[model samples]
Target: MIWKTIKVNFHRLGSPPTFYRLAEVLAPWLWGGFAVCAAIGLYQALYVVPPDYQQSDSFRILYIHVPSAWQAMAGYVVMTILAVIALVWRIRTVEIMAMAGAPIGAAFTFICLATGSLWGRPMWGTWWAWDARLTSMLVLLFIYLGIMGLYAAFEDRRKGARVACILILVGIVNIPIIHFSVEWWTTLHQGATIRLFSGESTLHESMMPPLVWMTIAVKLMFGAALLDRARNDLLDQDRRKGWVQSRLGETA
Candidate 1:
């Protein structure tokens, strides 16, 4: 019964109008959640948590860096799932959503790289290093840019999205590489401080709260931004359709 209901809703979401309306309704709530969570996370990270003995206040940067890195990878995984659905089902809404995720993922990757660099300069005595983790993350950013460029290169958006979906599938390898780079290679980047599967964490309990809050905030931000972008893409793609025309007429 549950599976049948899910299948029904999934088909309903493939309808452009249904998807657009859902995006419109959910995005604002997601954005609100992001704002509240981020405010609380920032407060806790900056004032509530004590500084590391070795890194001092500089460790606070991890609160932002870790979440951005996490969301960057998580966003790509979401795009990959959407891409697979698009390729197999030829669902136009899924294709647009897959494409919409690239820029947002790229933005998060940029933040991760930028903040990592800022954190590194003091710790590693260099602004940049070709460390395994850092190098793989840089590659991830390039892949994101390449996907966006490929999609734009074609005049037909659907065709472009199809080609880009293939690229998204191909790039899935990098995510695992990024995750395991620290374990596989000697690098300045630290290994996992918080382990999910093992239930073993090296990080102090007090520091965990801000990280948890910030992680949730970024996830919310990603969802909100993705839906907004997908909705805009849908509107632009369907501008000539009667539903879109009616929506514009109503808005006007």
Candidate 2:
């Protein structure tokens, strides 16, 4: 009985009205989590963590750069998965989720590019390189842009979403390329410091905490932003419906 009730609630949560209400309840908490995590993470990253013996103070940018890069890739994976659900189930809310996630993904990708350039300039002595990892990341950025552009081209957003969903699935090929490029080919970019298997992270204990915190912060920010955007999309879509009219009437 308990399991059945939970399953029922989960299904209802996928509906637009239920999701809109849930977003309203959850957005503030998620945003607050982002703020708190970001604050602690930045403090630890900027002041608590010791400077890299190799790169010196410049390496501090890793706090921002790594998290942004991680989220940039992670965001695409999430959108692609949601896109698949949207396509298979014909769930409009899930479709909105995919659309809402694209801009945030693109923003993080741009940050990754900019911060990577900054990191590279002093370390690699060049702002840009054709290194496999760097090139693949750049390609990832273009794919994100392509998704947004393709979505905007169609007169009907529903059709646009269907088209973009296909693109997302096709573009997922790039995620692995971005991740494994360093291993696959000769590259100037250093290998992963935080290995999931085998030995623990290469980072010192003090450094690892801040990086973890920042990663959590970015994820919370993504969730909060995604929910807010999805909620707005729902309201826009249902603007003429009675529930939305009543909600607006109450607010007015």
Which 10-residue window of candidate 1 scores lowest in summed lDDT? 191-200
Give lDDT for model 1: 0.97
Highest lDDT: give the candidate number: 1
> Would you list the C-alpha lDDT of every candidate in the order shown?
0.97, 0.92
For candidate 2, write residues 153-238 as lDDT tens digits.
99888889888999999999999999989889989999888887878888777789888999999999999999999899789878
- Runs with alpha carbons beyond 4 Å of true place in candidate 2: none
Model 1 lDDT at residue 219: 100
Score candidate 2 by TM-score against the native.
0.96
Most accurate candidate by TM-score: 1
Across 191-223, the per-residue lDDT of candidate 1 in tens digits comes to 988899986899999999999999999999999
